[model samples]
Target: MAAEPQTTDHRKRPRRRGDALIAAILHATVQELEERGYAALTMEGVAERARASKASLYRRWPTRAELVMDAVYSVIPDPGELPDTGELRGDLISVLTRTARLLDGPAGQALRGLMAEVLPSPERMGQVRAHAQGMGRQMMEEVTRRAVHRGEISPEALAPRRMEVGQALLRNHFLFHHEPISDEMVEEIVDEVLLPLFNTSPVNSAT
Candidate 1:
């Protein structure tokens, strides 16, 4: 009899645990978002790419939307670590520009896909909404707090809506418009909108 050939078995690979496994899965998720995009991404696809078990992903994220959201969030620049440009306009522009870049990448794809997914519970949808919006606000808060400390704006300038407007405008244009966001638009947002909104003098100025 002719010698039989043996094939490599992927299943026999050493199992990954804890952070290493989670990191691999998230990386695979982003790769899928970049390649297959969100609509076509499946748990099986991510598991196969990550060389992880589907059950591992399911154990952490019960739904595809949840998995995608977590994966997208993991890749976002941390708000607490954003650089301070020492002035409100510079800081605003830098933060918003970084966000614009994020929206132009896998994070953007994940958002578009998640928007179309029909979750079984309204609560699940709410969680998705919260996670999506919360990070933007947190980033704004980081910049705003720095501005306030530098006396560039009144503490009152840090209203919820004001904090949200820069990100909101960028997201609105990104979601609806066909073109990549322009430098002029980012500047206009900082100069024409955010700067004026945040230009309030101190509350005790008159005293």
Candidate 2:
């Protein structure tokens, strides 16, 4: 009888580590979200897809929501200070347009899904808002500061409520309209709404 051929075991590959592991997990998470969506995604699925252990995933992310958020944020760029385009209107348009473009991608999908999942829990909802809205306000504040320095707008225009106007409109359109944001809409937002608001003098409460 011929000796039995030895079989190589392929199931015991070395585990991915450090940045490689993180990249694999994040990539797998996004793929799973795109394929299965937030409601159906689980740690087991992500781990299997990443060729990692469940323990590895759990060690990094304590909850499904956190993991999904991380995956989504990984692909999105931080909204650093806006470029000084010389004119306030141009800068505002640039900021709003960039925001609209980001919301048109996987980041948008992940956000919508997260809202649906976390809305029932006040704590989770607050966390999501802090991450999403907080960043938007921060970017707007920076842009507003730049405009002030350039003498494009009065310092009195830099109010908390004013900073939120652009992002609020953008988020409303995104959540309700279910369509890619258009340049016309962004222009309208800048020209019709934000520019007028910033240029107007603040009303005196004592009057």
Candidate 3:
């Protein structure tokens, strides 16, 4: 007697696709960053944690730095979303404070790891530069544009370096100093460094 072939128990959770899959992968990346950190994080590790295939991660992010950058960005506020506090100082403080806060999280962890790993390779360094420069610089540019429109500062203040100053200082402190950047430090950066740099007399300096 020929026995009927047993059916396989093929009931598995419906696969996550599109944004859902991306979100799962990103969440897994963040968890890996927090737990194993960037130094130990790998695409295989992220894929395993996400319950997705290694090919899935590789298809989206070709490299570890790319994956880590996207994961860090996923949890942080959009750089294009500027805080309108009605004044340059208020906006500056608000933005800087937000960055300082993020530094205490997965973003900072990724930065420390990337900085260590990407320095030797120019290609990776460029990727890191793009990631670092894009976030804070875009925010600063919008904030500065608003300030200029408000007549709070002159257009001459919008130099590449000027836009980079606040973030550079914050990152320096975060990397070299310690965690949980203080509100007082943020305020000092806004009041002392950023404001002065942006509002400097035209006669005194250029950008």
Model 1 lDDT at residue 96: 89
Write model 3 residue lDDT over 159-195, tens digit each, in one string: 7878888999999999998667899999999888999
User: Which runs in model 3 stand beyond 4 Å of their true positions?
Assistant: 1-11, 201-203
Off by over 4 Å in 1: 1-8, 119-121, 201-207
Residues 95-155, model 2: lDDT tens digits: 8888898788767887898999899999999988888777778778877788789887888
Q: Please report, in order, the local distance difference test score of every candidate based on alpha carbons.
A: 0.86, 0.84, 0.87
TM-scores of all predicted structures: 0.88, 0.80, 0.86
Instruction: Per model, state how many residue pairs clash.
Output: 0, 0, 0
As a whole number from 0 to 100, the lDDT of residue 94 in candidate 2 is 86
Candidates ranked by TM-score? 1, 3, 2
Q: Which digits, one per residue and each the tens of the lDDT, describe model 1 over residues 151-179?
A: 87778878776777898898889878846
Cα displacement (angstroms), candidate 3, residue 78, comes to 1.8
